[model samples]
Target chain A: MNHNLFPGFIGLSAALFAIGAVGVLVRRNPIVVFMCIELMLNAGNLALIAFGRFTHTMDGQVFALIVITVAASEVVVGLALITGVFRSGRGLDVDELSEMRE
Target chain B: MSVIFGLAAAVAVVAALGVVVAQRTLYSALALVANMVALAVLFLTLDAQFLAAVQIIVYAGAVMVLFVFIIALLSPGAQERLHPLEARVLIGGLAAVAFTVVVARLTLNGVSVAASGRFYGRLGPFAPVLVDRHGQVQTLGEQLFTTFLLPFELSSLLLLVAAVGAVYLSRRRRAS
Candidate 1:
């Protein structure tokens, strides 16, 4: 009970963020990429809650709540865009979305 | 207490890895759900009861359901494999390592436990584990409504806009 869980929490957040970043870079599937983005957001959420607890304030929690709200909206827009892309019959692989490669 | 935190963190990390490593989008989505649930437990360990509930309800429950629904709608295609020596993979691995090192170093060195010890441990160990069954929620509601009212309202407007945009984007165009 006297132990410090802060360090562990921070490290875990870092690991999760790193995993998500790698997923974003390596994955070609748009849906997988979107999931990785969500993973990164969750990592951020964990860090905010951990910091809030260690600091003993409601600021972090409120911010985390706002983040969750934003993330939900972001997902809605992202999924819609993905749906639009699917309708175009161009496939879901991000590598194939090179219209702006120039 | 430490055991609980350690177990939850381990499960969370492994599940997050699953989210990244799973080939199928559905499996990755499932892994993400596990990760979110594990994180909610971790939040509980941190005494953030309200946040834990929100994490479960919003991320694990709603957001994940949307992800799974989208994955099903997208339909499956040929899997893309990453070669070990490919430039993109190598670059991404290097970036990930660098980011992890920088973030962990900042966390260990920049933030000190002793500094926040006073505020963090104001309440003694016996300190009412629940922190007042309704106290946490009350505090959250007060701050959310008073100090953070603007952001809260803005977020609602944003959500409304996002919903409308999603519907517009997904709707089929009528033939002229």
Candidate 2:
């Protein structure tokens, strides 16, 4: 078992992050955008875990756990905000929610 | 092992693309589930057994359920045309490519430096031998309770705050 798989994992992580960035940029629906953000966070977690494994440390996994916790909470609050927007009869498109832009 | 890694990576990347390209929100959620599952497999390959389980249970199981439930509840219609040829889309794609190139270069450079034995950073206490003897979960648990205890407790507090905020935000208010 080649323990030196760090570069491959890092490359995959970078690709995933880029894809998530593109999703965030192009997606208009806030929920989808939020999902993109999760994708990006997951990408970061992948990199952290890879680094941890490469260096033989548990810190990376621990940090990844914290990231997961934060992501879960973010999903909760983000979905709630989206739900509120839906209930308020506002357009679901993120662009339409730009009342603060005025 | 490399074969498995390659397959899992392919699945993850394809699923991630599906998440972005799917027109229907439900499909996007499903794609994300697939992507997360593939990532869990990748985690297992990296010797992070505990994270693999957490990734599957928390990400694929709990978080995705919330996304799908919301999609069902709201039933937002499919998005309008994605306009792949639009100028904004083109620019965003270009930017993402540039970002990926820079990150990949940095990662490759760091790994190569580490490989060349130029910098041997201090390794942690949880080496593979110790981890293998004690099991990944036990070692992680010990560290989590001791060294990382503060962040662990802070995360719990953050979760509580998030729960309260979500409830307040979603509460029904009388029409003014």
Top TM-score: which candidate number?
2
Candidate whose DockQ is highest: 2
What lDDT tens digits, residue by residue, belong to model 2 across residues B45-150? 9899999999999999999999999999999985755778899888988887787788778877886687776533556677788999999999999989999999
Query: DockQ, per-model, please?
Result: 0.63, 0.74
**Which pairs of residues have clashing backbones in candidate 2?**
none
lDDT of 1 by residue, A1-102 (tens): 343567778888988899898998889888889889988998998889777776656777889999999999999999999999888889888888999985
Model 2 chain A lDDT-worst window of ten: A1-10
lDDT of 1 by residue, B1-176 (tens): 88888898889888977877787778888999999999899888877888999999998899999988888877665666667698987898788878878887877764465556654557432233544655888878888999999999999999999999999999998868
Chain B TM-score, model 1, reads 0.84
lDDT for A100 (candidate 1): 92
Q: Candidate 1 iRMS, in Å? A: 3.1
Name the 10 consecutive residues with the lowest summed lDDT in model 2 chain B. B115-124
